[model samples]
Target: MEVKRMTDREIVFRLLRYEQANLRNYQNYLAYTKNKDLSAYIARTIPQIEGNIKSLNVLSRKLCGG
Candidate 1:
């Protein structure tokens, strides 16, 4: 199989999609879990996830010239 190059916009889109999926997974973990310690661990990681999203947004805007 041949690999194709992605444009900047496509890269940004994929990055944003990945970030969204991670956040969604964390949300689901929080929703269905009964373990307090695990929930606390997830809560602690929320800030890191938010930071990643912010960084990706900045990179996307820079790439798109928005």
Candidate 2:
């Protein structure tokens, strides 16, 4: 099998997808979490996750000429 390489744009798109999934999963978990401390921690990370997704989206768009 030949090895395949990913371009910077492709890599950024992949990371963007992963971060989107992470945000969805984290939000879902946060909904079910009952503990105050755990919920607070998860809530805090949500903003960071959102930021990552936002940044990744911007990077992906820039690389793709969007």
Candidate 3:
């Protein structure tokens, strides 16, 4: 089997897309969970997830020469 290498732009775009999806999932979990501890944990994680998305967006912009 062979793997294809991705360009920096491609990599950043894929990562940004994936992180955005994960952030949405986390937001949904936070909205639906009833347990207090679980809610707290998810709330804490949401900021980290948002940070990741922000970082990825920056990288994507840089890669695209924006």
TM-score of each: 0.82, 0.91, 0.89
Off by over 4 Å in 3: none
Cα shift from native, residue 18, model 1 (Å)? 0.8
Worst 10 residues of 1 by lDDT: 44-53
Candidate 2 regions exceeding 4 Å error are: none
Mind sharing the TM-score for model 3?
0.89
Residue-wise C-alpha lDDT for candidate 1, range 1-66, written one tens digit per residue:
999999988987898899889999998998989999999999988778888999999998888888
Least well predicted 10-residue stretch by lDDT in candidate 2: 57-66
Sort all candidates by lDDT, best to worst: 2, 3, 1
TM-score, cand. 1: 0.82
Better of 1 and 3 by TM-score: 3
Candidate 2, TM-score vs. the true structure? 0.91
Candidate order by TM-score, decreasing, is 2, 3, 1
lDDT of 2 by residue, 1-66 (tens): 998999998898889889999999999999999999999999999999999998998887788788
- Clash count of each predicted structure: 0, 0, 0
How close is each model in CA RMSD to the real structure? 1.6, 1.0, 1.2
